[model samples]
Target: MTNTPANEKWFQDRATEQIHLEQLQRAERFNGRAAMLGIVIGIITEGLTGAGIAHQIGLGPLIDGYTACRTQFLPFCF
Candidate 1:
């Protein structure tokens, strides 16, 4: 077939689609690896400090406060 404008546009569109698909795959791979690394780090920290990830990150007190407030039926809890 001749190298018409329509053919050029079609080829460009296909190329763009292929590039986008590749980028998405790469991003997904990176996200998965990062999540796995975070889990491993959390486990190591917990083993070393005898504290869970939430406690290490200071969420323990916040959670405890929420639980206490819920049980006490505090007016501001809602």
Candidate 2:
């Protein structure tokens, strides 16, 4: 069987659309991974900053203050 001009154009268009869709999906996945990595780094940095602050002020007092603050404020925030 032979393909007519219209059929050839249709096939080409379909292939192009498939390739474009795949590229978009790959871009979205990469962006999602990057965002997740960024969140993880942010959490780690926050934890490190908190730890340094705790060390400077003394661990026992920091924990007591955090516990008291959380206990008082967390219920209202939630």
Candidate 3:
């Protein structure tokens, strides 16, 4: 069809809508990364707590520090 005023308006509206959608997607991505970081910090905190407990009980040799903790709630060196 010919590029009439109505057609131009429609295109502009579509473009605006696309920009809004993209903005929302970026916000979601940023929030998701932040949430992941929080989760990792929580895991590290738990690892530290476990290590402290092991140390208190004289079991420090069985596991590593919190930095190497993965999968298991506590870090195990061996």
Candidate 4:
């Protein structure tokens, strides 16, 4: 039997949804791998530098500078 218009529309919708889902899954897998790689790099750098991840990335100094600037009490800022 030939497919009805309604059946064709439904099939098209399903195909579109499947494509969208596959794209999302691929993007998620890529993001996860990138995150893992970043973590590994950070760990290696920390080991070599003898510094915590935050300090290695300058996050510690940035936060300290921000806090000092906000409080206007610390000797160093920025």
Using lDDT as the measure, which candidate wins?
Answer: 1
Best by TM-score: 1
> Please, what is the TM-score per model?
0.77, 0.62, 0.60, 0.74
Per residue, candidate 2 scores C-alpha lDDT tens digits across 1-78 of 899999999999999999999999999999999999977776776587764434444586657667777889544432
Q: What is the per-residue lDDT of model 3 for residues 1-78, given as tens digits with 9 covering 90 to 100? A: 689999999999999999999999999999999999977776776587764545555666554544456557564633
Give candidate 2 regions above 4 Å deviation: 51-78
Assess candidate 3 and give its lDDT.
0.75
Ranking by TM-score: 1, 4, 2, 3
Across 1-78, the per-residue lDDT of candidate 1 in tens digits comes to: 689999999999999999999999999999999999999999999999899898888899887778878898666773
Name the lDDT value of residue 2 in candidate 2: 98
Residue 24 CA displacement from its true place in model 2, Å: 0.5
**Which regions of candidate 1 fall more than 4 Å away from where they truly are?**
70-78
State each model's CA lDDT, in order: 0.91, 0.77, 0.75, 0.90
**What is the Å distance of residue 67 in model 3 from its true position?**
30
Prediction-by-prediction clash tally: 0, 0, 2, 0
Of 3 and 4, the candidate ahead on TM-score is 4
RMSD of 2: 7.7
